[model samples]
Target chain A: MTASKPISLKDEGLEQKKRSTPMGDALRQFRRNKMAVVAFFIITFFIFMAVTASLWSNISFLDAPKGFKARHTINPAGLDRVDPYAEPGHCARDGLDQGKAWCALLTEEQRARFPNSCRVEIPDPNQRQWCYILGSDGGGKDWMTQTVYGAQVSLAVAFVGSSVSLLLGLVYGMVSGFYGGRIDNVMMRFVDFLYGIPGLVIIIIMQVYFREISSKYEDSSGIVGFIVEINKDLGGLFFLFIALGLLSWIGTARLARGQVLSYREKEFVEAARAVGARDRRIIFVHLLPNIIGPLLVAETLAIPGYIFAEAFLSYIGLGVQPGTPSWGEMISRAGQEGGFYSNRHMIYVPSAALVMLTLAFNFFGDGLRDALDPRLRGR
Target chain B: MTNVAKSEKVMTAPAKKKDYGDPIVSVRGLKKHFPIKSGLIFQRETAAVKAVDGLDFDIFRGETLGLVGESGCGKSTTGRTILQLHRATSGTVNFEGTELTTLKGNSLREMRRKMQIIFQDPYASLNPRMSISRIISEPLVVHGIGSERDRQKRVEELLERVGLNPFFANRYPHEFSGGQRQRIGVARALALEPSFIVCDEPISALDVSIQAQVVNLLQDLQRDMGLTYLFIAHDLSMVRHICDRVAVMYLGKIVEMAESEELYTNPLHPYTQALLSAVPVPDPDVEENRQRIILKGDLPSPANPPVGCNFNTRCPVAIDVCFDWDPELIEVLPGHWVACHRVT
Candidate 1:
């Protein structure tokens, strides 16, 4: 009998069929990856929160209303005459009863909920009736309002700071990697110099310098009520964004530079250069597209960095000023007198927000890294 | 014998008959020395690695000049320096009579369009993140060749020419095997339709059986497209198979140059003879009859090569003159140039 060869059973239907285009295939694979899908949702959730956080609560929750008209102006002495425990209707006029009446006017839930909370009149001509949701700070500004405003400030800062850092790092790294040799050496040396400096100390020094410059601008020649003008004209959101972004780009630049160094030597880059391509074209068209995957992952990881920085700075009282509603500020305010042990919600809410933000960003970053990886894209 | 000398004279005479043509690329007095640095805080340049030391050669039009050498003999460095991939410490590379060393920016890039290089390792050569189509079409896009449709068609054609399914144009480099990826690399090199290519050990990383296929493909492409190649390799047998003329390099200098058939049949340089003797013939009977010359000691450091002849330290037939005065490459016969005191 003739020796017989065994028929292979390894043939699958997918092997016989022509595969779709790589871009389409990559999209399909990305969709199939459950972790990546979940991460996409998480990223979407954070972005939605960041964009529409004010809409979820009162728009003015973090700010004093610009144009509020009061029904009556109360004398400060009159605030002392009111009985603390008297029934709402039996209260005497122009006494502590007014404060109690104002407190009682709040929903029954609020009355039973925050006992220390009370309404205060900002005798300032601009603001009228101000109710403290979590009570006032040492400056008698509404802590709840400040905390809400602080969210706007802190979140804006994180986003802006992270973006700036990402841009700077990507540019620096790509330049270093593309040119290499002496150029790489010089740029890397500068990076090392920056890295050697203590980050917190640098931030402190920068803040002190900027703060002085700002105060100078505020105090120069009494030009149309400066501090009040700046407080009104300069949104805390803008300051936070610019500050965090400027301080944060070095890390991203280092990552980009390393990736570019390896990538520039690859055959594809040589191919492009061989075609009489300009250096700019080779860098942007050939090199940059390959690096975007890593950059995306790096930027995503950097969001948490931005958040933590904002929280740390705010905790140390350099983050947000009074009358801003920031999660970090809320946590800071709550931590005073160890309120964390009693009013657990005060600590948990902002803490949970920060945690969720960081976790979401990390998940998205990991997903993006995998998605961008060429090896992972195929199968 | 008097008869042997006459035979040597006869062998070298007709070998010079090959046309030198208008030399397409000429590299003169090329030197690339990588500095060896010391000290922690302030790095001091202690010495230099003579990667490509005082090399001179010319590539005539439409000829595959095989650069055969041992590892670290500066074959690859020579290729890179010729392409200006490494800025030469001091050298002049003239491409189509244009002084390449002095050309900067746009002019240099314009010159590069006429020449390209294929790397050794297929795995690392192509970008892992880029699609085959992108990789192939990148040259076209960079040079502003055509619109999207024309570029697409060109990429597909190049892919097909390299024996890959044109449909795989969109696939990433990692999706392909070593051979297939090498084909993709070849396709990328062909995209710009350059006249000259530096085949930098193109098939060294491939399987032995697959190596022949790639070599054949390169030969076929060269014949059909009239492409000139500087095929650099450590494999002597493969170089013999593809090269028209072969230059064997030692350290950073060309030790011997002759037609492939002439070099194989009658090697003048001792190093060349030793190298040819080391190749394993396929037939068992011939292999048994061959005398393998096993040279002692590892190759000396390129940073500090031995004085006089670089190969004298390893030469099987080294005379006192081999150690006293370093030999210059001079035509022993009309065609064959050997840098050995014995040969001249």
Candidate 2:
């Protein structure tokens, strides 16, 4: 028995030696998943782009007309002066002249109404460079630059909104779960009450109400004046953060409460208590670490939901103000007059970005869930 | 060992009831009932699970008092209640002449430093995320006992004391086997230099081979530290091996308690007798010849126990009064206490 025991023990020792620490094991697992790795890189690339949006926007690919050059112009309504419904790649081929292939396509009455629609003589043809790589929107802003900048707003809202929810949820849930009895019942019921209310409708109403209040206090002095300045700077996106944060936390709160409720009864927690560890220590040091695996996964998964909600709100025109570059706002504009047919890149670029971001977050969250699960450890 | 047993028997002899010194911990009429709440919207009181219903016992200083019982007989609840881990619904636990039930906040915590518990499951007792050093040093950190360097030195010393390598301090609980983790649990429990430790089935979760090692370590610790232990377990042989006195519990009440050798040699209570009979003898001839008294029916639910004696429902020698009147623990022999109408 002793000889066999040593052999089996030696095998176990070898196995143990091969296995890394839990955190290291999780990282290794995450690296092993090819799709998750790809998603991680894609997310990182977008974050990089979002952070360096200003640098990308300043590149003078499309120069304003020089001396004796016919400048590309937009109508008062922000329509293209040459061809309002010009397809992507049209500007590069036509050089803003519009007479070559564009004029023949227009009706006689349309041509008569705007005689320079297709044929505008320009001395410096080189000045009319189509620098908008992903093409331009109806407002003629560079699509690529707007898309890059929009990433900043989307990611910021998602990150900040999720963080707010996570904080509130962790505190509220811990209090409810740890205390239990009447306090738990009352607090959980309040959570249920919040869950009963439709979050989207409340967010929209809050946005409108806060926007009106912000505008009224626009000139107020002191701290309120400072807040007003910030509000003006952020416009509706500021309120969007508040609304999203307030509305999205219920799920996290419920999850945290449930996790804590189960984990608080574990013998380790009881052991901590037996050692005369205070409630704060028990909750933060003992209970929190055990429940963090599930909470982390839940938080990761919740981020994509917030991002999607932001896009959804913005798509419906209840989100960020008209002037701000947001993915949803871009997608909304792409559904406008001749947008789908002519400037399809405007519709697809932002839409593709939004889909890719949500998918990346979800895939990464899945990897995290699998890697951090204690039951699946040493697999 | 024989001389100590003879002296303990003489001190606890029935004729001299007051000879035993003041108990280190005396629990009087301890009851811990968990309330059951039902209904979704407006929860109402449904029923209470009387886990530990009116237990009374005294644990002398520097001695191992074994609490043996069938599963769900509330041995664990009694231990936890004594430690004040679970608040008693009603009763008093006097630890070294201080009423523990009345103590609260800092006083209760200060009391807790001197009294610690080793849980049943080593796997669940130690935090998986914490290194052995952190787990052991936590009690010291909580009470602000020493500086960082002192705590580190103490942790390493504790690791060595618990029969584990000092270098294993940096490893997490999951890295160790069941026996190793139990040692870590012991190390953590001993960090405060607690005067009393409740070994709540400490070796039950370990392999049969490793169980003796843990028990020996615990016995050595008790001798070395002069620690009092309330050793709760269902394993009769092990209790007989280490405990000075043994208490047999049935449905949250102690049916019999006596010196370990006396109780095993001559069990007075019928339930105690039956319990002892269940233990298989090592000698095949004696095992085959011995009569095993198998009790009828499962343990009655503690939430709604039988009206009179809890064991009366299944007592082999129950009298007419056994069904109507509750039996009280009374001395029937020197150093032997039994709760049964027939025994008296």
Q: For this target, which candidate reaches the highest TM-score against the unseen true structure?
A: 2
Model 2 Cα lDDT, one tens digit per residue, A1-379? 1211122335346345754466887898888878888989988998998777767765522322221111323432223333333345545432445443465666777767555444556555556554456777665656676787788878888789878988898888888899988889899999999999998889889877877877788898888667767755764566788888886878888988899988888898988889899999998899888787888788888888888888888888878766677888879888874567876787888999999999998998888888888787777
DockQ of 2: 0.34
Clashing pairs in model 2?
A98-A118, A99-A118
Candidate 1 segments exceeding 4 Å error: A1-43, A58-151, A181-183, A208-216, A219-243, A375-379, B1-23, B35-46, B90-108, B288-290
RMSD of each: 8.4, 7.5
Candidate 2: segments with Cα more than 4 A from true spot: A1-21, A60-130, A211-229, B1-22, B38-46
lDDT of 2 by residue, B1-344 (tens): 34223334443444333344557998777889988889876889899998887766778888889999999999999999988889999878889988999889999999998899998898888888888889999999999999999999999888778877776777778888998888888889999888999999999999999898888889888888999999999999999999989999999888998889989998989999999999989999999899999999889888889988889889898888999978877767877778788878
DockQ of 1: 0.26
Candidate No. with top lDDT? 2
Candidate 2 chain B has its poorest 10 consecutive residues by lDDT at B1-10
Highest DockQ: give the candidate number.
Answer: 2
